[model samples]
Target: MNRTKILYSAAAFIAFSFLAGVTLQHATAEFVPEWVKNTAKWYGEGKTSEVEFVNAIKYLIENNIIVLELDQKKTESKTSPTFENIIIPNGNSKVGNVGFYIPLNLEIEKGTTVVWINDDNIEHTVQSQDEKGNLISLFNSDLLRTGERFAHKFNDDGAYHYFCTIHPWRVGVVTVS
Candidate 1:
């Protein structure tokens, strides 16, 4: 091609490469922002609860420090009401209850199915129970290993409490309305 065309092509290639590099960096960088590192450090030091650490991440998302983009059309097409899934993290030896669920309390509409994902290496069970510690018998998950998930659908309106059988201290509540 002509000298002018060659220069234009080279410039376009450089610009595209720069843009691609920036996008890759932003995409591959740890999802956690710098602001969350301090809270995570505190959690590691046993100064913060799992709920509080998750709330810190939520705060970052709310403030736009972390942006989450979802396909609205695809998500809305689902028959059942889709809710944000909860995560059960692994316990840290230094922190007593770091293995607890991220959200201690969750509120959802009736008929919504809540999924609890086991992100921890240890096994966990999600057993629904009454306030007096009696099993509800409606939903009891099997021993969940790492990367396993348990889902429960709440058809009626009430508050349901659940705990991990192995770790009684790891408790969570779900309110259906």
Candidate 2:
């Protein structure tokens, strides 16, 4: 592991230890081994190896003393759709179909950024439009060729309807709340 990763692990270990002390009211002395603290201190002070620090954290986690729910966070954690980038499918412009965009509608939380990539051979544009097909002026991308991309971060909460200027029928919506 790199020095930065070691430092970050040490910091998270200390923070979890502190949290365990406050939350584990029924925790016994056996739950928090003194060697773990020593290992964390030594690792943070550059006196211990990364493997030792990682082992100590593993021991605590295995014992169920510090259950980390940080990674289990929902929509907030997933900034984009399941597929990171929306693929402008092949033969998308030739015919107008319901599934023109890979994922027709993307529902995400506020402060999430969405990316659209033109994976087709022809050119395309990502522009925000209203329900009646009028331009909302929220965002507009330049004409993008194959393998080109456009990205926008949604800070406000609303349903964003976007369409390709070249192929008006190829549309997608991103609902941010």
- The candidate that wins on lDDT is 2
- Backbone clash pairs for candidate 1 read none
Error of 1 at 27 (Å): 52
Q: How far in Å is the alpha carbon of 33 misplaced in model 2?
A: 39
Please write out the lDDT profile of model 1 over residues 65-159, one tens digit for every residue.
44545446777887766665778876711246565577878888888889999888878889988898877787999999989999987889988
Query: What is candidate 2's lDDT per residue for 82-155, written digit by digit as tens?
Result: 32467787788876444478777888777777889888888999999999988778999999999999988888
TM-scores, one per candidate: 0.52, 0.52
Per-model CA lDDT versus the true structure: 0.68, 0.75
lDDT of 2: 0.75
Worst 10 residues of 2 by lDDT: 21-30
- RMSD of candidates 1 onward, in order: 23.4, 12.9
Clashes of each: 0, 0
